[model samples]
Target: MSAPPYHPVVPANPADADAIVACWWTLMAVHGPIDGRMYETVPDAQRVYREHVRRQIDASKGVVLVAPTPDEQGIKGYLLGGLGQRSKVYAVREVGMIFDVAVHPDHRRQGVGEALVQAALRRFRLRGLSDVQVTWSPENRLAHGFWQKMGFAPLLIEAYRKL
Candidate 1:
């Protein structure tokens, strides 16, 4: 098969919200086989995306980057990050916190995720930020390996339990 067309990450505006939601929904559905424990259904995934992901983007926090198909305007992947001081890893004053990243299943392993990450890093650098951090589940070995390959090292471990 031919390679999908590429586009640089652009700042996600309210106009792009629908596409972003659709892309995130597609990602959850595609990964349901492997990450089904996190999301029970597409609607559940949509609710979380709307309440948590989309709601976090504002003038004070961070920006969302979208990679839309060249032939189509729909999003194929996206990365959300923000400027924050994370004390768990270090005492750094300013760091880019990569909150979420996802690529459509049909587009996985094609460098989309890497491209999104690099784009986010570029944005951070442009904003005069030096450090970037990503948090993921320890059980997700695939994610761990991918982040390591991207030159990220584990700084801390956070555990959770049901009450």
Candidate 2:
């Protein structure tokens, strides 16, 4: 049989919450071990997404792109990003900030993440944003490697100390 056909990128709708959540959980499972935190309970993740991300998407300043199965039965990966004014040393202007990009374990190494990033970049260009940035935990070396391979260089580093 021929290899399964995959749609690398597709616009996400509010109805995509379930699929998006699934992808999010998968990512958390992968990274949580290094951070020493338990994976977020499903309800907690859902609440946060609904309260924050869903509203941003509805407001048109945010987007969630998904790579779904060929028949669109379920999503295998997703990228969430938003358009906003970012304060930079030079000036403040619209920029695209990618909050999350995740691909299911089975779909890893299949170019899904790259496709989603490209799609988000295209959307940012259409919105006239000047730049795009993604932030990930310092422990996530895999993500750092991926971003580097995508031609992104670290522009800033942040540190914090608790009193």
Candidate 3:
């Protein structure tokens, strides 16, 4: 469903932390089955993620942006991306990584997700990084489609077996 109109992507503030954490939990829960079993309860997950995001924000890894609901009621979506070398796990060099991105369920079909991604890319471009990468849960069709639609192609596949 199309989401209500939201503001274009803008830098999020420290005060936006709680809402973003809430959105992150929602994102994880939706993809948990596809990625892995999430042992952390929502509160625990929020605590951990809140700190993680803060560190990223302070480090200037890249950009943290929010798509706020109309009239600044709250955030409808957020994106976390950063500049860094490709993981040693992959045979690639420096690339921008979209660490996290989530949109409220009510805002799924709207353009919020795309706006956040484009905003991230714009930040990367300013940093002189062209190539970028994103990893989504293998079983997440929605994310799969979104990333693909965003012009990202599969560069590597990850396979693992429960020990």
Candidate 4:
């Protein structure tokens, strides 16, 4: 088979926040079906999320990456990650946290998502992070398989109950 199309992953600028948020919502849509309660959103979610993305773009510890579409008109995927700290008691005080990642449906399985992640990992390494973590619903097959394939093993299991 021919090689998957190559889309260069680049650091996102403030202007890319809209596109990045769009991808985020797409990812959330996938998760919503898997578990509505777990992925519920507020009325102002888009606006709130857009602001969050812009803040990350400006934050020193944050890493926001995007893969531009083949034509360069828009982004095909995005990954949001950043440096995070655990309680001071932990030996691993600082860690890398991948907040979100999403590839447009049309671009799935073509390496866009992986490329975005790999780029973020490189950035994390540059900032002296030794551990990177991502959380996704266990019921989402695509997420489960993809993260596992990317070498992540369960470090914690979050249990939730509805009242």
Off by over 4 Å in 2: 1-6, 37-43
Runs of candidate 4 exceeding 4 Å displacement: 1-4
Best by lDDT: 4
**Which residue window of length 10 is worst by lDDT in model 3?**
34-43
In candidate 1, position 78 carries an lDDT of: 86
**Per-residue alpha-carbon lDDT of candidate 2 for residues 1-163, written as tens digits (9 for 90 to 100):** 9764445788887887778877887777877676543343555766686566567557678878888878788887999888767557657467888999999888888888988888899998898877888877778889989999887889899765546
Q: lDDT for every model? A: 0.76, 0.79, 0.83, 0.90
Q: Which runs in model 3 stand beyond 4 Å of their true positions?
A: 1-6, 38-43, 87-92
Candidate 2 — worst ten consecutive residues by lDDT sum?
Answer: 34-43
Q: After superposition, how far is residue 68 of candidate 2 from its true place, in Å?
A: 1.2
Cα RMSD for candidate 1?
Answer: 3.8
| Tens digits of per-residue lDDT for model 1, 1-163 | 9875465677776666777777777656545675566546754656666655556665556768877777656777888888887557666688898977888776788788888888889888998888988987676677888899899999888765556
Q: How many residue pairs clash in each candidate?
A: 0, 0, 0, 0
Q: lDDT per residue, candidate 4, 50-92, as tens digits?
A: 9999999999998999999878778999999898989989999
Q: On a 0 to 100 scale, what is the lDDT of residue 54 in model 4? A: 95
The TM-score of predicted model 4 comes to 0.94
Model 2 residue 56 lDDT score: 59
Residue 141 of model 3, lDDT score: 87
